[model samples]
Target: MADSVRSPRERYREQVRDEVKRHAWEQIASAGVTALSLNAIAKEMGMSGPALYRYFASRDELITALIRDAYRSLADTVRAAAEGGTTAVALAGVIRGWALQDPHRYLLIYGTPVPGYHAPEDITAISDELLAVLLVVCADPAAEDQKSPFDVLLGAKRGWVAKVLASPRTVHRALSFWTRVQGVLSLELAGHFAPMGIDPGLLLAEEVAEL
Candidate 1:
């Protein structure tokens, strides 16, 4: 089915929403999400705080939208790379590029949880979507029989195996790849490597190569 065309008012609203999100990200980058203020944002944009509420019902609603966009962006990035026949290492490189381009956006999803903020179920659903992609990238069509202790454990869980249809080996590799990348990225982005005088990029590249 084709996408329905938007009316002029709808288009304007969408544009403003994007702009609002951009400013929200900047604010979060500087003072953290706990300090995100719709009124402050409004003041900066020269609009009344109540007027902004027309677009977002509450602060939590806006934060939820930001989280959704972050997850969606990462999911789309990985899916595109995988669909283009990229390998795990190459895909990891793409992820690193995405994170480097907007470190705050990357952290917004994976970094420390916002105080007093609990994500909704849709956030978990988007996360599962991302995991499904990793399962796809990890699968080896010719090597179905390979398994490890963890793979055996995962295989016994019929609920998920029945859904993702990935072999234990694929799942193991995918999880290992995910953890390694996350470990490197979280530390690197947190500025832990700067004090050590070691290159985080080379470390990340080496880890990917090992995988």
Candidate 2:
């Protein structure tokens, strides 16, 4: 009977933790980061004030966990997108799809700067992993072909060395694509397009075409 009671208690704890995180996400979506509060979230969950501290040390710790989860989710999305394609554009579209699905979540990582706010090292490391995936996808195959663009930039330079260093160009392309896509997404989420009567889908398509 004691073991059975222990299993149910653990399950209840997990359920409560998940409920709190869900409410926290809802609060974040409705208001900005400044609006997130453990007390409010607990109230929304029908729990007393002190109950949340058992799950999260503080609001900062909860925010940190959410950021980590966000990065991991993005990394997974990009990895799935890269599975069958070697094109940077393909990966860019995957990221765009993700942004469209949850602009609020996207902004949590890329929105307006917060003073004294620093992302945890693990989040940055996951971001690097995503960048590495983009790098691999953007590697130019034409570098080895006879009709390559290296001729314009590597004139009179060591061809082999230039080929080896072309990875930076791929990285630049990936970063540029991400930035452009994010701009459209952020503006759309903030209702910058509704007033102008512009269609964000068309803009997103144009950006993808430019890639």
Candidate 3:
């Protein structure tokens, strides 16, 4: 990697870029991404408005970087867990802790999208990496195929999962795992469960335990 043999200028550029992203995250934490502003970031960083453009050309570009980073972090964490032989339930706990530690970062990836803001291909690819890790974690490689109603639907869309998991049932399980955890997590992080007397973690563990 070029970073392995970085020159001074390249290192400096990387530092400045990281600082810009840090400020962007702070802004996101204070307000939503809709409130993000390059000009405002420039003012905070003590750099001219135009100078900030050297690092990120546009607001969308910065959002892309942040999204990519968030997805990459989750992917890397999942991969590490898989390598460490973590169980699916434990992996779910890892994800829960990560999201709770930084709810804004969690929402940045899984939160509602801004209208008309289509993510770039690279972002989608990184997202698929996260899914791939989930597949590996959730795959019941030794289990026999079990056809459900959704199996037919998922088989029709086996364009990606078929390559990683040999069993259709396993693919369906992985899908269920992702959707179920995400459903519970989104609400928990959004404070939807605060009004309820029950613990959200118990609810989440129950869902994952069933998986």
Q: Write the per-residue lDDT of candidate 1 for residues 71-172, one digit (tens) a residue.
A: 898989988888899877888888888888889889989898888788899998988887888888777777677666787888888886667667778878
| Candidate 2 wrongly placed segments (more than 4 Å) | 1-10, 143-166
Error of 1 at 76 (Å): 1.6
- lDDT (tens digit, per residue) of candidate 3 on 50-110: 9999999999999988988898898888888888998778888888888998899999989
Name the candidate, 1 or 3, with the larger lDDT value: 1
Cα lDDT of model 2 by residue, 1-211, tens digit = 3546678878777777778878888998888777889999978778778988899878887887778878889999898878876465556667778877887678888887545567778887898778778667656665434333544455445654344445545544555667777888788888889999988877876785575
Clashes of each: 0, 0, 0
What lDDT would each prediction earn against the true structure? 0.85, 0.74, 0.84
Order of quality (TM-score): 3, 1, 2
TM-score: model 3 vs. ground truth:
0.92
By how many angstroms RMSD does model 2 differ from the true structure? 6.0
- Which is the leading candidate under TM-score? 3
Instruction: Give the range of the ten consecutive residues with the poorest summed lDDT in model 2.
Output: 143-152
How does candidate 1 fare on TM-score?
A: 0.89
